[model samples]
Target chain A: MKKRLFTPGPTPVPEEVMLRMAAPIIHHRNPEFMEILARVHENLRYLFQTTQPVVALSCSGTGGMEAAVSSLFGEGDKVITVNAGKFGERWTELVQLYTGSSTEETLPWGSAITPERLKQLLKEHPDAKGICLTHSETSTGTASDIKTLSAVIREHSEALVLVDGITAIGAHEFHFDDWGIDICITGSQKGLMMPPGLALVAISERAQERINEPARKPSNYYLSLKKALESHAGDDTPFTPAVSLVIGLDEALTMIRSEGIEHVWKRHESLAAACRAGCIALGMKIFSSSPSFAVTPVWLPEGADWTEFNDALKHDNGITVAAGQDAFKGKIFRISHLGYYDELDMLTVIGAIERAMKAIGLPLTPGTGVTAVQKAFLGK
Target chain B: MKKRLFTPGPTPVPEEVMLRMAAPIIHHRNPEFMEILARVHENLRYLFQTTQPVVALSCSGTGGMEAAVSSLFGEGDKVITVNAGKFGERWTELVQLYTGSSTEETLPWGSAITPERLKQLLKEHPDAKGICLTHSETSTGTASDIKTLSAVIREHSEALVLVDGITAIGAHEFHFDDWGIDICITGSQKGLMMPPGLALVAISERAQERINEPARKPSNYYLSLKKALESHAGDDTPFTPAVSLVIGLDEALTMIRSEGIEHVWKRHESLAAACRAGCIALGMKIFSSSPSFAVTPVWLPEGADWTEFNDALKHDNGITVAAGQDAFKGKIFRISHLGYYDELDMLTVIGAIERAMKAIGLPLTPGTGVTAVQKAFLGK
Candidate 1:
C-alpha cells in the first residue's frame, strides 16, 4: 500500500533527514556530537523565532508542557488554562496537578478563545501566576490568536504566558519575542519534519527567572528546565539525549531555513485553504470555526458509517487521516498538512476523501472536491 | 574514516535494525505499530527475565530512574543509596532530590559492595522505605553482585529493591523475578543494541502495589509509571512514544531471543575476559576489582598523554573508546563490550590500543595484546 500520512503530528519526515539519522550512532560526549548539538541549538532558536535558548527534551510534546508547569509554577500557585480542545485541557490538568489550583477559560472544542474573553478571565483572576493555552489545538483543529491574547495578558496581569506551539510553529505565523511569550513548546513530528520523541521548548528570560525563584522549587527532575538550561549553555544535555532525533532536527531546521520561514507559512496557508474549500465542495461542513493551518477537520454526513468511510480512505486509497479524539471520536476525520506538505498533497487527500465519501454513499458530486481544491490551490 | 563504536551505553546497532528504522516511519496509533508494540512487549519481558510488564518511556535511562523514584517513593521517605561509582552517585542524587532523605553506604569507586557490607547497611537502615543501587557503574567500570545484595536486603529490611541495570541486563546474568527486585531500568543504547531515546523499566508486582498506595501520589506527569502501566494493559502508551525506536527495538529483541539469553551473557563474558587479558598484556592495570562484563577500564601508562592516545586510536585506527569520567578522567580509558561485540572485535580494539600506545611513545610489544586476547577468548 502507498500509505499517505495526514495525522496532525508524525505527518511525514523528509527522506534525507531519515537517512541522516540512520547513519551509525555517535557518542553523545564526543566532539562530533557536541558540534551537532551546537548547530541544533542555534537552528532550533531560529525555528522558534526566539533569541533565548530552546532546549530539546527527549519526550513527546506533552512532556514539554509538563516541564513548563512543574518548573515554573510553585505549589498552590494560581494559573489560568484555556480549555478549547484536548491539548488545552491538558494544560488545565497539568497546571492543576502541579500547582493544586487553576482558573479555566473554556469554550466549545471548535471555538477559539478571543482576546476579549481572555481579558475578562484575567480580570476575574487578577492574581494568576501563569497563563497557559495551546496556540493550535490538534484535536479540535482550532488556533487561538496568541499575539492578541498575549497582549491582553500583558495589559491585565503579570502572568507568564505559556503556549503549546506543537502544531503552530512551522505552519503558523509566530513571533515569540515580539508577542511576549515566556514559554513555547513544539514537537519534532509536527513542525520539525522528524519522527516523534523529541520536543523543543523555548523559554524566555522571564520564565527562566520564574523557574529559578526560590519559592518555586523544581518538583520534577526529569523535565527540569533549570538543569536543561545549565547544560544547554555548554551545548550539552542534562541527561543522555535522543541524539539521532537531534541530528535529524538539525537537517529539518536547515530545510526550514532554506525554504524561508515566511514561505513555509504561506505554503501551509494555501494547503489549509484548499482543504477547507475541498471539504465544502464535498457538501461537508468544516468542524472548526477558527481552523488552524496544520489540520482540517470535516464533519461526517448524517447517516454515513465512519468505519466504512475510514476503511475506504485507508485500505482502498492508502490514505490515513486521523480520527477525532475525545468527545468527537468517530464523528469527524482530520486531514493534516502540517509538515513536508504541498498543494498537490492536499489535492490528493481531498480526492481520496471524496472517493471514500462516495464509497460510503454520502451525497457528493464526482470531481467536485478535487476541482475546488485545484481552484483554491492555484488562487483562481 | 571508517568508524567503530565501543561506548558503554551506545554500542553499535545492527545494520538490519538501522535500515528498518530508516524506512518511512509508520503512525504510532496505527494497527501496524500496535502489532510491533505487542511483539516488543513480549520480547522485552523475555529479555528482563520477568513476568511483570516492562514499560517503555521516551527518554534516556536517567528519566527511567526518575520515574521509579517519583512513582514508587513518597515525599520524605527514608531511602538508602549505595555509591560505588558514577551511576551509584546518580542514585544518591536522585533519591535525595526526590525523597529528601537517603542513607549512604559508600564504597571506593572501583570496589564492589560485598554481601556482608550490604547486610550491615540494611540492618542499620531497617526503617528505610527503599534501597537504591546500580548493577553496573559505568564511570569506574564496577559491577556489584546485585543478587547477593538483593538477598541481604530481603532478609534484613522490608525496603523495595531498585536497580539501575542500564549496562548490565543483556550483557550480564540477571534474574529479575527470582531476585525479588521491585524495579529495574535499562536503556535502548546499552545492552539492547539500539539507539538512545527509549528506556525500558521492569516493575514487579510489589512495586506496582507500592505505586498504588494512597500516600504515593505521582509527582510527575510525563514519567508517571502509573499512567504508563494503565496504558500498557491495552498495548499502548499514554503519550506519543518514540515510534521508530520501538520498531527498531522490536527487531533488536527478536535477534536477542534467537541468540538465547544465556548465550548472550556468555558472549559478553568472553569479550570481557579477552579485553581484560589484552589490557594486562599492555602492562595496564584493570581499574576495578569487580569489573562488569559490559566494559573494561584500564589505567594509562605513566607518561602517556590521554588526548594523544585517544587521537591515535580514533584518527589512525578508526576505533573510538570512551575516556574515563569523573575523578578518573585523563587517567584511564574504557573499552566497552556491552552489545553486538564478538571476540574478533575485542582483538581489533586491543590492536588499536597497542598501536595507539606505541604512537604515544609508551613501551609495548606490538603483537602481545592481540595474542593475549586470542588466548583468553579461546579459554586457554
Candidate 2:
C-alpha cells in the first residue's frame, strides 16, 4: 500500500530533505556543521520574522515550550495561560509546574480565545510574569489572533508574551518583531518540512535580558536558554545537536526561503480554504470556529464509525489523517495542510475522504467533495 | 571526496538504518510507530543488559543525563558527581543546578575514576541523595569500571547509581540489572549506529521508586522521567517523539540484536585495540590511561600543528575525526571506533591517518599504521 501522511506534524517531508538526512551524519563540533547551523539560524530568524538569532535545541517542540517557561519565569511566579485546546492546556500545565500561581483563561475546545478575554485576564493577573498561548492550536485546529493579544499585553501588562508557534510559524502570518513577542517556539516536523527532532526557539531582546538575569537559574542543563543562546551566539550548540535533522532543516529552510515565508503562508491558507470548502460541500460541519491554516477539522457525519471511516481512508485509500484528541476523540477527524503540501495534495485527501465516507455509507456522492476542492482552489 | 564521520557520538549510521529514516515520515501517534517504539524499548533493554523498558527522550545524551538528575533528586539535595572529562563536567553542572550542594570527585582528563575512590566518596557523603557518573567519558575517551563502581556503591551507601552510557552502552560491556545500576542513559548515535536525536534511558525498579515518591516534584517538565516512564508502560511517548530517528533506531537495534550485544561490545573492543595499535605503530602516545572501547585518544606528535594535521586528515584524506575538547584542545586528536565500525573501516581510517601524516612531512613508513591495524585485527 502507498501510505500517505496527512497529520499536522510529521507531515510529508520533501524527498530532498529526507535524502539530506539520510546522508552521513556530521559532528556538531565540525566547522562544516557550524556553517550549516549558522545558515539554519539565519533562515529561522527570517521564518520567525525576527532579528535575534534563534536557539535550536536537540528536542521536540514540547521541550522548547518547557525551556521558555522554565527559563523566563522563576518558581512561584504568577503567569497566565490560554487554554483553548490540548496544546493550550499543555501551556497551562507547564506554567503551573514552575509558577505556583497561574490563571488559565480557557474556552471550550475548538473555540478561539478573544482579545477582550485576554485583556480581562491580563487585568486580573497584574503580577503575571508571562503569558503563554498557542499561535495555532494543533489539537483543535484553532488559530488565535496573536497580534491582537500581543497588542493587548503591551497595553495592559508588563508580562512577557510567549507563543507556541509549533504549527503556525511558517504556515501562518507571524511577525516576531512587529508583534513584540518575547519568544516564539517551533518544531521541524510542521512548517519546517523536516522530520521531528530539532526545536527552534526565536527569542526577542526582552526574553534574552530575562534569560541573562543574575537570579535566573533554569532548572535544566539541556533546555537552558542561557546556555543555548550563548552557544548559538558563537554558532555552536551547547550539546550534541541532532546533526542530521539540523542538516535536513537547513535544506528545508532553504526551500521555505526559496518559496518565501509569505508564499508558504499563502499556500497553507489556500489548502485550508479548499479543505474546509470540501468538508462543507460534503455536509460535514467544520470543528473549529477559528480554523487554522495548518490543519482543518470536521465533525463526523451521523452514524459514522470512526474506525471504519479511518480504516477506509488509511488502509483502503492510503491516506492517514488524525482523529480528534482526548475527550473529542471519535467525534471529529483532521486533515493537515501544513508542510510540503499543495492544492493537489488537498484534493487527493478530500477525494480519499469522500471515498471513505461513501464506503462508511455516509450520504455522499464521489465527485462532490473533489469538485468542491477544485472550485475552492480555483476561486482562491 | 567521500566524507567519513568518526566523531564519538554522531558516528556513522548503517546504510539500512539511514534508508529506513529516509522513508516517508510516520506520525508518532500511529500504531505502526507505537509498535516500533515497543520494539526499540525491548531492544534497548537488551543493549543496556536490563529487563526494564528504557525511557526514550527526544533529545541528546546530555538531556538524558539531566533527566536522570532532575527527576531523581530535588532542590537542596546533596548529590555527588564524578568529573573526569567534558561529559562528567556536564553531570557536575546539572547536579549543582538542582542540588544545593554537590561533591565532585575529580580526576585528570584521560584518567578513570577508581572504584576505591568512589567507595571513599560514598563513605564521605553518606547523606548524598544520589551519585552521578559517566560510564565512558567521551571527551578523553576514558572508560570507567562501572560494574566494580556499582558493586562499591552497593556495599557503601544508599546513593542512586546513575550512569551516562552514551559512548559506552553498546560499545563497552554493561550489565544494568546484574551491576545493580539504578539508571543508565545512552543515545542513538553511539553504538546503536543511528543519527543523533533519541536518548535511551533504562531505569531500574529502585530508581522508579524514587521517581514515584509522593514528595518528588521534579523541577522539569520535558525531561521528566515520571511522564516518560508512564507513557512507555503504554507503549507511548510523553510528547511528540522524533519518529524518523526512532524508526531508524528500531532498525539499528535490530542489527545489534542480530549480531548480539555481547558481540557488539566485542566488535567495538576489537576496533579500539586495532586503532590503539595503529597509534602506537605511528610512534604516537595514546592519551587516555583507561582508553574506552568507544573511542581512542592519541597525543599529536611533537611540533605538529593540530590544524594542519586535521586539514590533511579531513580535507585531504576525507576522514573526519575529532579533536580534543576543552583544555586539551589542539594538544591531541581523537579517533572513534564507536558505531557501525569494523576492521576494514579501522584500516581505512589508519591508512588515511598515515597518508595525512606523510602529507604533513612526518618521517614514517607509508604502511606502518595500516599494517599495525591489520595485525591487531588479525590477532584479535
Candidate 3:
C-alpha cells in the first residue's frame, strides 16, 4: 500500500528535492560543495526573512534550541520561557538545564500567549536575559502572535526574543528583522519538505554581539554559534554537517522562493481551513481555539477509540495522521497541511477520515467531509 | 559535462540507493520507520562483524569520532594516538581538546603504525586510558594492521582500542569482535555508497559497560553514547535522525549483503590493484608503502604541475579526484575505487588520466594505463 503521510513533521518530501539530494555526495571542502552551501545560505536567509546568516547544524530541532540556549547566555542568567505546548516546554527545560535560572510563563495548552501576558511577565522580571517562544506549537496546533509579542518585549524590557519557528517559517508568515526577533530556530523536517536531520538557526546582530561578548562562556563545543558564524563566512560549518540534507534543503528553498512565500502561506491557510470544515462536517470538534495553518488538531467524536480510529486510517485506508501527544493522547488526532501538500491531498485525507469515522461507528454521512472540503476549496 | 566522482569520502551513490532516498519522506516516529531502523540495525551489525548494537548518528564521521572521545574518557586521562596522516592527526587534536593528556606517536606520512611501535608507546605510558588508531588513513592511502595492533593492546594494557574505520569498514576486511576492537566508527559516504550525513559506530559490550558506568561523566549533550544505547534498544535515536540517508543506507547495505561481505572486500581489493597497476604503467609512483584497498594516492611525476594535471582531468575529461592535504597538497592526487565502483569505472578513470597526462605534457603512452588495468582485471 502507498501510505500517505500527514504528520506535522517529516512531511512528504518533493521528488525534485529528493532526487537532488540523491545525485552524488560531494566532499565538504570541495568547490562544488561550497557552491551548494553558498546557494543554501542565501536561500535560508530568504526563507527566514532575515539578513543574518543562518547557521546549519546536523541534528534535530532540539539541537538548534540547545545551541541557542547553551551558546547565547551564561549561567544564572534569567530567561523567560513561554510554555503552551510540548515544544514550549522544551524551551523551559533547556533554559533550566543551561542557565539554571528561568521564569516560565505557563499557559493552557492550545492557547496562544497574548502580548499582554508577555508584557506583564517582562514587567515582573525586568532582569530576564532572554524570552523564548514557540512560533507554531505543533503539539496543540496553535500559532502564537510572535510579532505582537516581540513588540511587547521591545517596549517592556531589553531581553532578547528567541523563537522556535520549526513548523512556522515556510508555512506561515514570518518577518524576522521587522519583528525584532533576536534568534529564530527551525528544522529541516517541517516546512522545508525534507527528512529529519538538519537544524537551522538565524541569529540577529544583537544575538551575535551577545555570543561574541568576551565575558560569555559557552558550554558546548560542537554546536558553538560563534564558530558556526566564523565558518559560515567561508560558506562552511564548524563541524561536519549533513551535506545531503542541506542539498535537499537548497532545492526546497528554491521551490519555496519560486512559489512565493505569501502563496505558500495562503495554500497552507486554505488547506487548514478545509481540514477544519471537513472535521466539523463530520461532527468532530476542532481541538484548538487558535489553530495553526500548518496542522489542524481535531477531537475524535465522543467515545471513539483513537487507536482503532488511527489503525483503520492506516491499515484500511492507507492513510496516516498523527495521534495526539501527552495529555491529549487518545482524545485528538492531527492532520498536517504543511509542506508538499495540495488540494488533492486534503480531499484524499478528508475522504479517508470520513470513512474511518464511519467504520468506527461515529455518526457521519458518507462523503460529507469530502463535500465540505470541496466547498471550502471553492471558497464557499 | 557530467562529472565522475572519485574522491575517497563522498564517493558515488548507487542509482538504486538514490532512488530509494528520493522516495516520500516518512515520519521518524512511525511504525514503518521503526521497521526500517530494525533492518538497518541488523545490517550494520553484519557489516561491522560484531554482536553489539551499532549506533547511528546524524552527523559526519568526525562527529562519531568526537562522540567517542567526549563520552568514553574524562579530563586528565592519558591516551595514545597514532598519527600517520591527516585523519590520525585529527585523533591527536580531539584527544588534546577533550582529555588534555595525549601522547602522540607521530609516524612519517604514508606509513603505518606497527604493533611494535604501539608496544613501545604502551610500555612508556602504561596509564593510557585509550589507544586511538585510524584503520585506513584516507589522506595517505594507508591501512594500518588493526588486528595486530588490537592484539598488542589487549596483551599490554587495560586501555580501550578505538578505531576510525571511516574509509576501511566496508571496503576492507574488518572483524570487530575477532579483532577485539572496542569501538569502530565509519561514515555513510565511503563504503556505504550513500551521501555524507550519517555515521555509524559499533560499540563492544566492554565499551558499553564503560559508557554506562555510574561514575562516567560525558561532556556532550546531543552525541551522548549512553542516550544513544538506550534509544537504540528501542530502534530509536535520542534525537531525530537523518531519515532519508538511513533509507538510502538500507538499500546500500542490502546490495552489500547480496554481494556478500567477503565478495565486497575482494571487489575493492581487485579494483585497488587495477588502479595501482594502471598508475604504475603510467610511470606514476604509488604514495603509500602499505596502501589501502579504498583509495590510491599517486605522486605527480617530477616537474609536472598537479593543478594542470587535475584541471585537465576535471575540465576536459569531466573526472574529479582528490588532491592531497597539508604537506602533500599539489604533490599527490588520489583516485578512489571505494563504493559503487567497478572494473569499468577503473578502466574509464585510467583512460581519462592517460589523456589528461598527455594533454598536460607528461610522458605517457596513449593506451598504456588502460591496457594495464585490463590486464590486471584479467589477472594477467
Clashes of each: 0, 0, 0
Q: Write the per-residue lDDT of candidate 2 for residues A201-262, one digit (tens) a residue.
A: 99889999999999876666789899899998999988888889999999999999999988
C-alpha RMSD in Å of predicted model 1 compared with the true structure: 1.2
When summed lDDT is taken over every stretch of 10 residues in candidate 1 chain A, the lowest stretch is A213-222
Q: CA lDDT of A160 in candidate 1?
A: 96
Model 3 chain A lDDT-worst window of ten? A215-224
**lDDT (tens digit, per residue) of candidate 1 on A1-380:** 78899999787999999999999999898889999999999988888788999999999999999998989987788999989888989999899889887888888989998888888888888889999988999999998899899999988899999999999999999988999999999999997889999989999999988888776666878899999999999999998898888888889988999999989989998899999999898888999999999998888866778899899999999999999888898898899999999888988998998888888888878899999999996667
Which one wins by TM-score: 1 or 2? Answer: 1
lDDT per residue (tens digit) for residues A233-352 in model 3: 999987667778888888999999999888988999899999999989888899888899999998987778988898889999989888898999998889998899999999999999
Considering just the first chain, candidate 2 attains a TM-score of: 0.98
Highest TM-score against the true fold, candidate: 1
Predicted structure with the largest lDDT when compared to the true one: 1
Best-first order by DockQ: 2, 1, 3
Q: What's the TM for chain B in candidate 3?
A: 0.99
| Model 1 docking tier (incorrect/acceptable/medium/high) | high
